[model samples]
Target: MNGMTRIEFLLRLTISNPDVHTAIIGTLNPDHLKTNIAAVAAGPLPTELYTEISDRLAKFSQPK
Candidate 1:
């Protein structure tokens, strides 16, 4: 997510939700207006992928 380009992040989010707002569109350059642009560029994950990641986190967090 950190290394993802602005274009790649938007494309990934759209893949999960076609209704997602496009207001997030903007440049990745560090500037006052570009805030939240980083989140948009982080991309959204599919439900399954998100669930799997959460499960992995739970496993790691369990007491040994």
Candidate 2:
């Protein structure tokens, strides 16, 4: 949702949690692997961004 790419956001989301130590991503294409590497190197999302994402998911994923 921020300036980060969708892949970056997803990876950073996974990396943000203290309980999470590893995230496995599979790819066949070289470019995809490169993008994934860059995403991981970008590191975890900021606390505010992570909380905003979790909050949005909780809000929208509720039964309507």
Candidate 3:
């Protein structure tokens, strides 16, 4: 989404919350660490995208 790499998009999702202080991710691989750093550099998703994702998730999680 938003033409960003999947890692970037997922990292953005992980860090979007103000209440979230830290992220726990696999850090065993040196290359993975570099990828995580790059993803964080890309920052969070746009507000519109975040809101949309939240809304969709809420609906999805509702009893059907």
Candidate 4:
């Protein structure tokens, strides 16, 4: 999935705000899309952190 897309942000936002109920039924559908992205933000754990940590440990091997 393209991380830069609004859809990705919307999906993440929805997951984060599951309790924000709305009277507008259509707004809750999976097809609902966000054009303005003032609310969506990247998650707390950046994806690059995991990759960097894994790369740093690539040389370590446990004894058999």
Which one is best on lDDT? 2
Q: Candidate 1: lDDT of 14? A: 63
On lDDT, the stronger of 1 and 2 is 2
Ordered from best to worst TM-score, the candidate numbers read 3, 2, 1, 4
Task: Give each model's whole-structure lDDT.
Answer: 0.57, 0.87, 0.85, 0.43
- Per-residue C-alpha lDDT of model 3 across residues 1-64, encoded as one tens digit per residue: 8888788788889898676898888878999889888889878778999999889889979988
Error of 4 at 9 (Å): 0.3
TM-score per candidate: 0.38, 0.77, 0.79, 0.25
Model 1, runs deviating above 4 Å: 1-38, 41-43
Model 1, C-alpha of 16: deviation from truth (Å): 12
RMSD of each: 7.8, 2.2, 1.7, 12.7
lDDT for each residue of candidate 2 in 6-62, tens digit (9 for 90 to 100): 888889899987879888899999999999899888888889988888898899889
Steric clash pairs (candidate 1): none
lDDT tens digits, residue span 1-64, model 4: 3454655444444534435554232355444434322224454224564345445656575345
Candidate 4 TM-score versus the reference: 0.25
Best model per TM-score = 3
Task: For model 2, state the Cα shift of residue 62 in Å.
Answer: 8.4
Displacement of the residue 60 alpha carbon in candidate 3, Å: 1.3
Looking at model 1, residue 34 earns an lDDT score of 55
lDDT of model number 1: 0.57
Q: How many steric clashes between backbone atoms does each model show?
A: 0, 0, 0, 0
